[model samples]
Target: MYRLKPGIKQNPQRRWELPDRIFFGHGACHILAGTYLEIAPLKGFHAERIIPGDGFAGNHIFVTDGEIAFDFHGYSLRNKLLLHHTSGWARVSDPGWYCRIEDVDFNLLDTRALNARKMLGPDQYFGDPRIRARSFLERIDHIDSVKKLARNVD
Candidate 1:
């Protein structure tokens, strides 16, 4: 059986703001999302909606096959083992001055789910959240869109 592990506890009143850092000439989180989405499938993994905060809800996520756990590279964040936008070396905490998402594990944050309405409604955006998430997946799949929406807050 799959489990709905506790994710982040965010204030729904606040909208997600873009990460202040410009990573690889684009928004840090966007680049993180895009790049990770680009690589996940090659390893037989798919993208899942997640909540971002100090750390991800779980070290594992439920997939159709089963549950998969985080693949931290011997060292994760000291900050509550916070999930990197992408996991592995040169990850969210270690994107360096500029880098790519290759050779990295996917984010532990991706293990957590974001309540669609609660997360998006405050921004006055009303639509199926899956649409946007899947769209981003498709974009990354085609290598056309490197932009991922950072729509939820922690």
Candidate 2:
């Protein structure tokens, strides 16, 4: 059985935000196609075509069957890493999409689901055993710290 997961929590302190201009819908290739057309000023990437289908929250966007192409500026390892890490199911949270890379097959993902699944790595998609253990320990530590602080206050 397919299991749908809850969306990720965005960091409230982050400075960056997705522009409100990007409208999401399930069969809205026209909107996506228009956004691609407008992004030409950026000069590095362009959408070749848009195939309409379902996405996260039942939104739609155009997506290619194979790898999507984009152009980059001069050699920069940091930029390369950013692009690489953000690709596939790795960057879903940027658009409020909740799907994860290692958890779902990309070929079968619709635009909405793909968007939702972006940004999540295998560790975030699936809980890490070590982290879970550490979290319990951290909770204990937090209680101890709070007790000490309370005693000092008293």
Candidate 3:
């Protein structure tokens, strides 16, 4: 028989609801995927940054309006992972896979500092960061492959 892992449970009432409008300038948007996001240029004149160790609890889903270049727990990557209408961004570390919304331009709003303070919180899980990183990297690889295939067909 198989058993569920600790902190992993099936919610009978789980649902997925996409927001009507997920654009920049919106305060904080909550999604059905258990992620909370805020747009860039949060409230100051600096680029927003999310450090996993700084009280950033739970899995976050961020969509940046502009390119976000940073190193996740030491792994460096340039560019935002997710994009949407609101120019919102996230910094999550959950083990589950997340949906990716594509085709949005990056914003250079100077609210990163303020948004950092407001957005920083305790994460729900601190499982293996490598596992989560690998998952995201795999997704990125898959996206790149699809894009290359499309280009080849064209």
Candidate 4:
């Protein structure tokens, strides 16, 4: 079964909804296929990052934003994602062929965020570490969400 992965579709009608102020945080989960669920920087998505042997748990994604006050690579991130949108760490079920935001407990997009530049930024394979360490981890940086998110991956 081929489910649609979220991205900026050429057709506006096809755009997925996202909650307001959702910084994809960092990192992405890889599904059975070669595709990945990385932060849609909107520009720097590299196929090279998602390797067959690479697990989504430890892979680092360069996330940047001024408001994020949590760990960029751990449990804190999962909370933030759940609290804001795409609840329960999205993943594919019912055969587990791909990862998708299924039966979300919360709404996915802010009315404004979907149409704004928020999702149009460039996706980086690796961003500035100094900024990432400081910016992505302001409030809850110690907790790791890899395990929390892994459960969702079937």
Candidate 5:
């Protein structure tokens, strides 16, 4: 059976207030999504990198499998995830949301996600966002099939 995990707690009241690590919702979507793209496959899950589709401008990125999306806020339905975007930046349903990154295309998205690592500046407690993501996964009870991924990864 597939298990759904509650979304990761985001700093909704105070952005960037979490001093110990780069807060996932605070311009760190790329980092979180990029981490999943790299790690999920190794654990036998398929993850696709995505960005907002045409006519919408967004600074966020996430991973999905055409149904659930994994981002700084953990796993959630793709549309449900967008509803939580109350920051008044992007309108809901604008540009029809999510566009997939083709495998053949030059991935400026991944490059940006990778480049985001250096921009954390003083918030980089764990040295890298991917490391922080792993730490987050280890402590949380996410999907059922991959519950052991963190402990099992070498």
Candidate 6:
């Protein structure tokens, strides 16, 4: 549930042949974070899309408001998010462990997120991440949390 590999362990591409739900916190992370970035403003919160530098694991996308990060696992301290993606290495193994956020680069709203089919290529493994993200938010009852975060920010 933490590392980048399918479910925190190495898996063949054939494993990814499953549904997007199977890869929720794994491969479909970009879509989840991108969905948050797209919806934050509408909910009255300001967030920036973040793409960790090469120092970290594989490609990962998340949103930050300078304090908290919103990703596939939901909200977390912006600083701690990197630790969750050490690519199976120890938390301290990553060169950016201490300053991962500082080394991160900003990304614009991902166009691929707009169409689930465009995310991972022609497979369309994920039907529509936006819908999935919304479902996750609702299922977790995070509407109030989102409102609280929004209210606390400028």
Evaluate all candidate structures by whole-model CA lDDT and list the values in order.
0.27, 0.29, 0.27, 0.27, 0.48, 0.51
Give the number of the best model, judged by lDDT.
Answer: 6
Off by over 4 Å in 2: 1-25, 48-154
Task: Tell me how candidate 1 scores on lDDT.
Answer: 0.27
lDDT of 4: 0.27
Every candidate's CA RMSD: 14.5, 20.3, 15.1, 14.7, 9.5, 6.3
Question: Which candidate ranks first by TM-score, i.e. highest?
Answer: 6
- State the lDDT at 108 in candidate 2: 22
Per-residue accuracy of model 3 over 1-154 as CA lDDT, tens digit each: 1222333222211111111121111222211111212221122212233223333332223333243321221111224232321123232334432343332232312235324544311221123222333333333343454355447556
**TM-scores for every predicted model:** 0.23, 0.19, 0.22, 0.19, 0.50, 0.52
Name the lDDT value of residue 116 in candidate 3: 51
User: What residue runs in model 3 are displaced by over 4 Å at the alpha carbon?
Assistant: 1-83, 87-116, 120-124, 139-143, 149-154
List clashing residue pairs in candidate 6.
none
Candidate 3, residue 137: Cα displacement in angstroms equals: 1.2
Candidate 6 per-residue C-alpha lDDT over 54-101 given as tens digits, one digit per residue, 9 for 90 to 100? 464454556666666666666666667766654434443655532233
Q: Could you tell me which 10 consecutive residues in candidate 1 have the lowest summed lDDT? A: 145-154
Over 4 Å off in model 5, which ranges?
Answer: 1-22, 41-57, 86-126, 145-154
Q: What is the Cα-based TM-score of model 6? A: 0.52
Q: Between 3 and 5, whose lDDT is larger?
A: 5
